[model samples]
Structure formats: structure tokens, C-alpha cells
Target: MELQQMRYVLAVAETANFTRAAERCHVVQSALSHQIKRLEHELGAELFARTSRRVRLTPAGEAFLPAARQCLEAADRAAAEAAATVGEVRGRLSVGVIPTVAAVDVPAALRDLRRRHPQVRVALRTGASDDLTAEVANGRLDVAFLGLPSSSRPTGVQSHELARDHLVAVLARDHPLADGGQLDLADLSAEPFVDFPYGSAGRAQTDHAFAHAKLTRDVAFEVTDAALMAQVIRHGLAIGFLPSAYLQRAPELRGLAAITVTNAPSRVEYVVWGSPGPSPATVAFLATIGLQPTPE
Candidate 1:
């Protein structure tokens, strides 16, 4: 019934070990166990099944975990709102990003957010769009900036389009067709290819482009890091197909040329968050990106 007791129960349920749960709660094992026992006595049901090897959540525990997390999140937000009313925003803000992003000036946005909300601590997690999308839905991330398919969208979350950037062919300055100004996938069919890893959001666009042309590229390298891929292209190790904006922004690919690919698909970058309602930090960050504020 007590907020502290609710925290203890959730911790125990999450860790599945009373000792580790107590450690996480910064309390002695006996104190945490006593609180959980008191909670179970009040509910008139066992919340956990303990054995010599492991602890498993009982049916009651499984059902109670979500509500406990919601209560904690609500309490934290109430405290944050109270602080904000006094002209202070004091809370942790966690944002997720994909490996490569061209839709938003993320660094500039973060700089502005930090300037405006000095009390807010921020962290960034990077991954592919699919992985980061799941993180947002599961409440691990407050917002995610990443590339999503122009034709397909994510479920269970709200997404706002930030920008659509074309995927273009990149090659060394002296390479053949480097000065072509405009090219297509078929032009690179016989060339050594470098690209984002297959099945990724960026690679999907490139793959779709090739499939549309009925031509298969001789991809010699698949890289996830844009800087490294640019370096690979600059050395003439392989030709690359990446976001045009990304190549433009990367100083590492200074000697490379980006060819506009006619009929190519653009990687649409979007900002996404959970549907429970946008977090205050997420809304504030979006403002710098010129989005309408997410209402509470």
C-alpha cells in the first residue's frame, strides 16, 4: 500500500532475487523481504514463487507489475510538474537514435534543449530504428529519432515526420561517373559496393531501389557507421549508396562525390514516442526541431 512498498515489490519482481532487489532498492535484504511479505499479506495472495535456484513471479505479481510501474512513473511526473511550476525542470531525459539520421539536426537540438533546461540530465541510446522503436514503446526511451519506411509505419507508437532525404550513390572524385551529376543503381551494377548493413532502415531503401531496377549490386562491404562507410568510399575501396544529406554533412567524405539517383527512394526520418502521452522532455526537444508542442 505504501509507495516505498510498491517500489520494493516492483524491484523484487523485476530482479527475481530478493537479495539483488534489496541491493537495487538500497535496502537490506530483510527490510525488502519484510515489505514484500507485508504487501502480499495485505493482498491475501502470494506474489512470488521461491526455490533453491530462482524466484518466479506468481500470477498476482505478473498482473501487479504494470500498475506498479505506472504508479511510479505518475509519481515521478507529478514531482517533475511541481518542480516545473517553480520554473525548474528537474528530471532525466532519455532519447534514442538510429545509427544514421538526416531528418533533424540532433546535435543542435540537444544544445538548445540543454541551454533551456539546465536542470535536465540527458542521455542518448543508438540503434537501428526497429530496436529503438521497441525501446520507446517499452518506456525505456522517451523519444526516438530514426529512419522509417516511407511506405510502412510502426504500430503502437505515434510518429511525426521530420524530413525525407534521398539515398544517393557516393563514389571517389576520380572514379568513373563521379561527375555524372545524376545516376541510378544500374550504373553501379558492376562496381564494388559498400552500403548500410542489409535489413536496416537505410539499407532497405537502397535494396528497394535495386529491386525496382531488377539489378543486383556487387556489395563488397556492409557497414553501419556512416563515418567509417564514408572513409571506405573516400579510399576508393568500394562505391556506396547512402543518404545524400548524410554525405553532405560528413566532413570525412570530403573527397567523395554524391550522385543524385533518379527514381531513388528517400529515407523518411521520423520522431516517435509512446502513446501514453508525450514526455515533457520529449516535447521540449521537439520544439527546437520546429514541431508543434505535444500537449500534456
Candidate 2:
């Protein structure tokens, strides 16, 4: 029996509706039915019992389902290994990203990844750190750059903490405490603060810092983008904490007064992935960002 036949069988078994299975398998219902019928003939046994309302797996189908899944998985692994060894990686790599979380130079990394693997294509999607982590866990993403807890990652996924930057408080130049040169989490306790949304790395770090000090601030706004949060700080809307790199990299941000928060938590970014065999393009992308195929 062919792999296509086995896939059709599995799809039908899962959906229990030939039409739905056919749609999922990207084939006409008639064609899928033909393949399943042909496979059953080859095996000298009927695999599915079809009725007007539903399809049920026969005893033979139930017995064959696990083996069929294993066969497809093995084929995928063999194909991946062959592609890895042949030469430059030439396939699509789906990458999920979080804003300001991983501290990666994504443009530079992509440029170098393209130079190294010209045939590879990279697809980028931006989301919250938790959302990206979920995508990585479900294998919808080949890899992601996110701010994740060191030990709370999904079971099948691995994450490596590449680097960490200290969090600093950003504020208007005219703010009362801006001239202090340095501050602490408690210093901002009375100020209405702007913060990263829950589940984002920056937000997590800030929360930990406050919790460690047994203090809480009045959060006036929750934003995911550091640039926007900085803008709010610049307008004197509220104080906010940003990775020191953000303060250093953006020229416009330099106009604002930024102070180191001695008691604030440091935010670490991670490069994370699911399973083991990533495409050549993904491996190249990782290397461009000062990483290796192995996960921590």
C-alpha cells in the first residue's frame, strides 16, 4: 500500500466523515474513497464501515492505524535527514517573534540567514510571548524568539536563554525623579506606571521585581511594544521599564531621561524550538543570531 493510501486511511479514521477527510487530505471525495477501497482490496480486508451518517473503523483498520502513523513519521524523518545533508537548506521556515522580548537583531539575522541559505524562505509572525510559545509547542512554528520563564516552557519544546539586559526606568526629562540618575522599584511605587502586557517577558520581569520588594504600582496602561510604551513615558503619561538595550539603540529614546533600577529584575530572551530536526533554513537563522541547532 502507498503512503497516500495510509494517510487517507488515517484521515478518514480521525474524521469519520469521508467528505471531511477528503477535504483535509486535499483530494476529491471520490478519489479518496477510491484509494481507501483499493488499499482494502490489497489487504484482503475491509478497513472502514461506511453508513449514511458516519464512518467507523473496522477491526482491521484499528489494528493498522498505529503502524500507518509510524510509517509516515519515519518517512518525514528520513526526508528531513536527507535534505539536511544534501546541501543548502531549501524550504520554508515558519518563525514566530515577540516584540522586544528576545533582543535579537532580526533584520541582520535574516540577512545573514539568506546569505548562508539562499534557497530557504523564512516566514515571520509576531505575537505575545505566551501565544508564540503555544505555537511553538503545537509545531505551528519551527522556532521562535520570545521572553519565557527559565523553567515553565512547554514539555516538548526547548528554550535557550541567549542574553539578558537589565531593566531601566524610562520617564519624561521633567519628571520629578528623572534627575536622580538611579532608581529602584520602590521609587516608582507611587507613580502611575505603564507596563508590558501580562505573559510578556518585560512584564514578567517587572512583576517579579515588585513582588520581590513587596510593592505594587498603579498600572495605567498595558502595552506590548516598547516603542509605544516609551512614547507614553515621554509624554509623562506614566513611568515604564525597558531593557537597557532599547534605551541605547533608539536615538529618539535618548531624548528621554532613563535611569537604572537597581532592584528591578533583569529580562532574559530565549530562542526556542519544538522537536529535533529543524529545516536547514531554521538552523541557519539560529546560527546567524549567535546560536546553534542544539537547545538548552
Best-performing candidate as measured by lDDT: 1
Q: Which window of 10 residues has the lowest lDDT sum in candidate 2?
A: 147-156
lDDT of 1 by residue, 2-75 (tens): 88998998888778899999999999999988988999999999889999899999999898888988898778
TM-score of 2: 0.69
On TM-score, the leading prediction is 1
TM-score of each: 0.73, 0.69
- Deviating ranges (above 4 Å) for candidate 1: 1-75, 85-87, 293-296
Clashes, model 1: 0
Per residue, candidate 2 scores C-alpha lDDT tens digits across 64-91 of 9988987885675466557878774766
Question: Which runs of model 2 end up more than 4 angstroms from their true locations?
Answer: 1-81, 101-103, 149-155, 294-296
